[model samples]
Target: MSNPADLGVSSLVLQTAEGGDINPVYLGIFVVYLLLVLAIGAWAYLETDDVNDFWVYGKRLGPWLATWSYVANFVSAVSVIGFIGAVYGDGYSIMTGIIFGLMLGVSGLYFVVHKVRELNHVTFPDIIAELTGTEVARPIAGFVLLANAWVYLIMQLVGAGLLVTVITGVPYEYMIWVIGGVFILYTVLGGLVSVAWTDLVQGTLMVATVAVALVYITLDLGGIVTINQQFAALDSGYVAPLGDGTYTGLAVLASIVAFFGTIFTSQATIIRINATDSIRTAKIHLAAAGVILAVFYTMLIMLGAGTTVALTDAGLTVDNVDMAFPVLITEYVPTTIGTVIIVAILSGILSTTDTRLHACGVTTARDIYDYFTGGEASDEKLMRVSRLSTIGFGIAATAIAVNPPGTIIGLYEWRAVLLTSALLIPVYVALYSRDTPGKAVLLSIILGTAFGPGWEAFGAPFGAPPTFMGVGMALIGLTIGHLVLKGQKETPAETAVGND
Candidate 1:
């Protein structure tokens, strides 16, 4: 699952009149896009020769391919749909969370991320194990990766199923199977090679479609000045810096911490960094993706405000924020462009879903499985295991998606908290503080999960985002472990990532 698009935190539903005829155009676009993606999977099967190719696409990534894959894998309905939905409620404050938090994560990453490339690793666990010099790092980081990927997969599947169900008028239950089955199939057959190339296609279309939607909305509502006036007319705070205080400063700060965790530690990031052909390409691609995301998100402001104005003029009000953009598309936008928006939304979801699902495969075959193998697993044998694991996790995630757990934001939070709380700092430490004891790394992870997600599970007693406490404790654990465990233990040897 790419993202529930948490677009703010709900399934996207485009409301229509009773007995509305299903649009053949949407069905055609959706079907054609899926076939093309599946075909890429088939081709990648040929490109993949061993586990090395399966995991990091043979490290042959260039600037454009990496840039497209990077952005597409990160963007989901949440960015296009959920974010626009967020604008409906919080207004400009939401922009700070997206623009400031994510942009900083990407831009700041440029400084230190090259070292990640230099590591010559495969999955996230590989890096952690290498940097921490501990065997325990693999299983611990592996489990967290699965947890993150599992929840994230369900998030994308639900969003994707809803998209197909609503657009094609397929039952949600049936759409879940169709969408879930196909993503699992492609991911297993192709691995990162297929995933990366498909992301390029998905990413380009995602940007173009949203850009079109934002442009149409802007013109239809007579531009940003007119859109601002319309929203200001709705409420002065809509144009105010804070946007009605739906999300306070504390909330924004917490979100940034959450964003940082995901950026620093997620498998999606590790593979992208390592997959690059050169460190320079990784830097350039990441910088480019950052700028593109900035522009794309800035357009979300217009998509939200402009759509509000357009939909209001049409005498429609969507109580569900997730429905706002979809309603805007079906009712206000031209038919051709509307179909493109629907297709892109689904494509965006799959683009992200495939990336996350691939992470699950890495966690299983590379992370957990490798621990048992002790770095001696044959390349062909490990490749088979990766494929088997991909299929297994895909089926599991799809089954869960058919009956997803919790609300959208709650589900997406699991994806963030586990990795962010546990691995974010450890990842950086491994990069910069290589001398930090293995015990310190392990404790940082343990306390981070305890304070972040463990705290969240207990209802977050402090009434703040879990990242605040989780990361706080993570830092404490790191410092304490360093002071206590330093020189008391001999660090384990660094085992090279075997399949590579």
Candidate 2:
């Protein structure tokens, strides 16, 4: 089955007229850029000492690199393609939901970063086991983290393939293989070091490219004055913050919850936090990410809105609204710089993909294999397992991307709903509370995991978001279980030893 992007989401007829032609000079630049990425990975591998270095890079990331890593990981291709498409196709109001959601995520991170760093574990599940005093929490947190990561990695791969195809006219199938291989190579080789440094490069380019686009595009359209006048000439609903009848009250509310869930429960974000050097550094990273996202999203929203006005004024109709940004780049921007923008966008997606792939390795080694095997693996043995796991997971994600289940944004939302429902409260309770019994946690995990999908299958009663229902069910289960069981006190066990 063709993926959603191939089937309909990116099938803008104008793509042929506008994006079919490719410049050899631009392709050459992109190829050189990719080659540089691989070279960096090889250098990172040379510095790798053990499994710890591979997983968390010795927890030595300072503020700037950490900030770039966090920003790059947070702003993936899904955010660009999925979000821009939604804004273009619908109304500008979706931007509000995303912006607030991101801010909420940053806020949650502020509260947890210090504790997370102190725990000093490579994967989230290791931290969970520390606080919950139950070995089972490892697999529970690990499985959900891995599952959510896989779904998201696949979404990124799908987005990467689509973006490559639109820009270079390469066959999507071929592009998928190339993209997947490149991601696995960097992640499997150098681990977090490779992912982090490359992110520094990728994140800078990503933001610069977007900032340039916003300025260049705005100037080309005459000015902010001209852009606003153009917007004013269009349908009022199109320019409004609320979408054009597509995003209802319930849908907007659900998006808000979903965004919060994504940030709060995101393994990718948490893993980045664990990689930072200190609590102070982690907060700096979070604060910087918030600032970067504010600028990035503002520019992106304006670009999407401007694209809509420009395309409509030209009397062109796009079959798939997701092609809005691509069409704008192809038709308007100068060829050389446009090629650079394409690389920047491609880098944004790759940055996220590589992070998740590295995360899969860390979680698989620390949480799943080490926990089940009594935690006795040698560092050499552990490093071997982690690299192998990264490769294995990368292949699995590629297979799923072959026939993606939904649009980029939809798949992202589904993953967020599951993560929030299954893992959010458990994670929070584990990190911050001591009174909640491990038994209660286990039961809450089961119910919260079941409730979200169950509600989706039967009915989402009272128009409550799946995340809302799942979180509520978890809170209630945790409370009742605590009362009935009078939870067992945790045994003092220092598991954060080597992790630090």
TM-score of each: 0.93, 0.92
For 1-500, candidate 2 gives per-residue lDDT tens digits of 11233434333322342434565665566578778889999999998888778988888989999999888888886777777776666657766556677677787778777888787776677767666667778887788788888988988987887776667766666667788998899788899999999999999989998878777768777877788677766756666665566556766676677677778777777778888888899889998888888888888778776777777766665566556666666666678658767866877888999999988888888888887777888888889989999999999898777666666876776777788788778668856776667768777877888887667556577877777788789888888888886645655552332454
lDDT of 1 at 335: 81
Could you tell me which residue pairs clash in candidate 2? 93-241
Error of 2 at 447 (Å): 1.7
Task: Give a tens-digit lDDT track for model 1, residues 1-500.
Answer: 12223333333332321214566777787788889989999999888887778888888899999999999987875676666766776566666665576777787788887888787777778878777778778888888778888888887887777666666666667777788888888888888999999999998888888788777777777888998888888767667665566656786788777876687777888888998999999899999998888887777677788877787788987665656776776667888778878866876889999998888887788788878887677778788888888888888888877666653455765667777888888668757988888778888888887778888778778587788888888989999989998876553354334435
What's the lDDT for all of these models?
A: 0.77, 0.76
lDDT of 1: 0.77
Worst 10 residues of 2 by lDDT: 1-10
